[model samples]
Target: MSQFVLHDELWWVSEFSCESCGTRLCEHAGPGAAPDDVRQALLAAHGSVTLRPTGPAPGLVPVLRALREASGVSLPQARELAAELVRDGLAGTPAEMGLLRDALHRRGVPADVQS
Candidate 1:
């Protein structure tokens, strides 16, 4: 049987591995979304999580900085992700989104996660 493991680590990093074969499929670090295939696999094995900012709007600069610190993305990339968080929100594995939600909250950005 083939089995996969997913790890959501620091810096918004995620690692994927095969348990049966000891194969490492991916080790991604940064704020970018995981590949569709990886997402699908995770969804199949685990579940999905959605994260959205709640309460009053937070300062853009703080949001941007939080995104940068949490995701290890550059300023411009963090800007784009902060925009997305403010606009449509973000989706990922439970652990992934949970880490982000905590990071944002620590930076004084109110956010919630649903899984």
Candidate 2:
């Protein structure tokens, strides 16, 4: 199972359990993307949502900062993400997209989440 958790910052956890043996193990993540397998599972099960920037171009600086604060991506990664936002926006789980939408809003960038 994979779950999203909110703490001082956002986090994610995945767990495995054995029904017969009653054994369990879990993994936790910091404030950023979940593991690739976990994310893939979620997308396969629930589909993906996209965030689209609306109105005039918001510029690269605000988008870079939004990606940095919301996803904790490195500066170079943020730059790439910013480009994607201007080009086609970004896609992820609803929660992930919402996090970015709000971050962009806070930076005065107009954007919306699309299901």
Candidate 3:
């Protein structure tokens, strides 16, 4: 399994094969995050990343909206994420944090990714 952000989109691809039986399967998704299990495995292997706001704090509305769009989460989820950011930053895999960071920057909300 491999997942990363490319061309401003998340690319998730998984390949499964059996050497003896000569059977193979592949599942790939476009423009979105990987399944939770895959993401968790990556996070466990590479450690976690944190995205925190930097510079001056921005308005709540823009922050929430940026987070919502970046993560493709609902408004309430965005609020929770925003709260998490305010508390200890948003924590996730590198791809996720980086994508969120880009989104925040695009929305004029300064942020930094900590690995």
Candidate 4:
């Protein structure tokens, strides 16, 4: 139910992802370098179609900054870490959070137990 906009030589409305990252700018081309091709490729690979404009969203910038600060990492480093977690399948699905919690417990990191 979320919405996103793909804008290049033209614009289209679709679902949202981290589109503002320029990862899907040329995703819709059947076989060319147009931003549309990039958009389609992104959807096929990452499962989203909404293209974000080429800049950080005003509000999200500060929030991301805070997360990075708290984690003691730069924004790019934090993003890379998250991406690695996803790629390595170390992250859990929403439904799998409970299972992940149990696994974490077995590893001695009890949930809600605080540091």
Candidate 5:
């Protein structure tokens, strides 16, 4: 059996790995759809995830903090990610966004994940 893993990092980076064959690929893009091959591999491996605010807008400060904590990014990068979260929403592998969702929730920013 083949085992695959999908990791969604800050800056819209997606890393795909297949344990069976030691194959790894990384895709980096702006705020848009993931590359077709990466998307397909992610869907096949861990499925898709959409993370959106469930309650009112959580304000930028808390969101930025959460983004930084979850992604280990610098303040500026986290700010950019927070902006994207508000503007375009967040999509990634379940575990990646799940961790962010949980982090935001802990900071009193309610969010939901659609898979």
Candidate 6:
């Protein structure tokens, strides 16, 4: 088995693969999986919700706390949401952040730290 690490600004995805069987442990999905559907299913199953943290230090702590209080979402779900926000640029701009926060609130999230 061969192992590899894939890192981004906010994620560290670990992958394992067997060169012989071509089996791998990764989030690296094929094109047919459709990122949107994969994301949505992940969100629903994990109870993940993304939000922009308040103030200059945008962080995932507050967003995770809020979701925990609001829906008792698991840490993994919160983690997935945090990852998505970081990837989707939801935390990059006011409008985009607002959209993400609003979507979370609609899904029963209690707090939105987004400005």
For each predicted model, how many residue pairs clash, with residues at least 3 apart or on different chains?
0, 0, 0, 16, 0, 0
lDDT of 5 by residue, 1-115 (tens): 1122234332345656889999988645443334567656766877777888887855778898888877678999998887777777798767568778887997899888886
**What tens-digit string does per-residue lDDT give for candidate 4 at 1-115?**
1112222112223333465684433223232122445455444554522111222223434434433443346888756643443344233222122333333333343332111
Model 5 residue 97 lDDT? Answer: 80
Largest TM-score belongs to which candidate? Answer: 3
Among residues 3 or more apart in sequence or in different chains, the pairs in candidate 2 whose N, CA or C atoms overlap within 3 Å are none
lDDT on C-alpha atoms for all candidate structures: 0.71, 0.79, 0.84, 0.34, 0.71, 0.43
Ranking by TM-score: 3, 2, 1, 5, 6, 4
Winner by lDDT between candidate 3 and candidate 2: 3
Write model 2 residue lDDT over 1-115, tens digit each, in one string.
4445364245666677889999988765455577789888778877899999887645778878888988888999999888888789899876688778888898999999888
- lDDT tens digits, residues 18-81, model 3? 9999999887766677888888777777899899888765689989988887778999999999
Give TM per candidate.
Answer: 0.65, 0.78, 0.86, 0.20, 0.61, 0.29
Which of candidates 2 and 5 reaches a greater TM-score?
Answer: 2
- The order of the candidates by lDDT, greatest first, is 3, 2, 5, 1, 6, 4
Global Cα lDDT for candidate 2? 0.79
lDDT of 1 at 88: 81
Which TM-score value belongs to model 4? Answer: 0.20
Positional deviation of residue 1's Cα in model 1 after best superposition, in angstroms: 13
Best lDDT among the predictions, by candidate number: 3
Candidate 1, superposed: residue stretches over 4 Å from native: 1-39
Kindly give the stretch of ten consecutive residues in candidate 1 with the minimal lDDT sum. Answer: 1-10
Give the clashing residue pairs of candidate 5, or none: none
Candidate 2 segments whose C-alpha is farther than 4 A from its true place:
3-8, 21-25, 29-32
